[model samples]
Target: METRTVVAECIGTAMLVLFGVGSLVLAGDYINALGISLAFGFTLIAIAYAFGRISGCHINPAITLGVLLAKRIDIRRAATYWVAQLVGGIIGAAILFLLAKQVPRLQTAGAFGTNGYGGRSPVGLGAGGAFLAEVLLTFLLVFVFLTVTQKVALVGVEPIPVGLAYTAVNLIGIPLTWASVNPARSLGPALFAGGGALSQLWLFLVAPMVGGVLAAVVHRFTHQRPVGQAQQEQAAEPPRVGPWGRMRGGHRPEAGGPEAKGPEAA
Candidate 1:
């Protein structure tokens, strides 16, 4: 694995939490829910463009898991990304925590932008409702990401749909469970919020992973691969491309296979 790729994942995931979650923690009262949703969407778009070339800019562990299941990236690489994203999320949350402390009378204890259910939920959504909501919400986000990135024709415009999908999920999920399509996003804030947030953290993590798996399975059936292509993709070293230029690793090559023109070739 390349060091730069890992670093990019770390930085990109940190930025996602810092700006996306930060908007809710710092400015939720002023910006409101829609603004917070936009914050996350906008941050994802920025990260996709900024680090897309280097790491495919997954940032979220759920996305990485989906990508791994799709055979886009190997398990070792996925594991590395997961670690990087978790660390980055914590780092971003720690920074957000410090900043929140600076504001007088600002509360960061119970909420801190963490996902939850029951009394912690905004609409009083129960545990079962929260779980189902997260699964469906995350399914939409991951499904969009997989669909957009897989098509060779949609290379440059991938971020738009993926980011919008994220925004859409947040819009619906905020009232239910504060929208935890990304586990790293939830874990970061919960660690600092402690107490109930920690207890409720499992749903955020497990549901997203389930959603990711479901997306991958559905994608396989929906987007059928060419006969023999699966074996080739598994055997050969796949080409890499920036998010704008070509499908990321584990995607069909631009021309067809490994010999297809890549970012460097272009």
Candidate 2:
């Protein structure tokens, strides 16, 4: 990975956590679940425009893993992106921690937006339910991202659907698991929240990864060929004769139709 790309990933991920988690920790009560979900969704849209060109704006580790499994990125670059995203999440959480200390209510609040289940869950969902929620929600998010990004028609506005998907999943999964579709997003707050948050961090990590892999497998079957692959396939085909020969029109390359073969010439 290019140094600038890695730097962009770091900054983008940091911004995601800063705005997304910050909303949950600082203003969650005022705005409620809808507002928090919008906060994360809009943050992703903004970062996609800002850093999408530089690093494809994979601020979330799950997104990177999905792309990796689809063979869009090699393992080494994916590893680099994962490290940058994780570091960025920690840094963003640290900054939130420092800022929260100034506000007594925010500082006293539990978890600092960390994801959890059972007693820790906002809705008291059990571990099995939480895991299933994470997997299904993350799968939806990653699948939307992979498909929309590859769709030629959605070019420029690709981020919008991905952002909306994030918001929708959060709406459905928030009360259950706090909707940790991104492991890096979960890891940051868990490190500081400790206690139950730390103990349950593994679920956040494992479930989203599983979701990403499932999305990748589904994408591999349904995805259209990339431009390079399409071009290579076109090149490998036998040369055609007429304007619509060997494809639509039934004009064979014989009987002076185009390139008459020696079988006919002889």
| TM-score winner | 2
Instruction: Quote the positional error of residue 106 for candidate 2 in Å.
Output: 2.5
Candidate 1 — worst ten consecutive residues by lDDT sum? 250-259
Best by lDDT, which number?
1
For all predictions, the C-alpha RMSD in Å is 11.6, 5.4
Residue lDDT tens for model 1, 1-266: 78998998888888899899999999999999999999999999988888877888888898889889888888999999999999999998999999999999998887899999999999999999998898888888888888888631223778899999999998998888899989899999999999999999999999998999999889888986868998998889655675655556634455555534569654
Predicted structure 1: lDDT:
0.87
For all candidates, what are the clash counts?
A: 1, 0
Model 2 lDDT tens row, 29-117: 89999999999999999898888778888888988999988777889999999999999999999898888889965553358899999
Tell me each candidate's TM-score: 0.84, 0.84
Q: Which residue pairs come into collision in candidate 2?
A: none
Residue 217 lDDT (model 2): 87
Candidate 2 accuracy as TM-score: 0.84
- At residue 216, candidate 1 shows an lDDT of 87
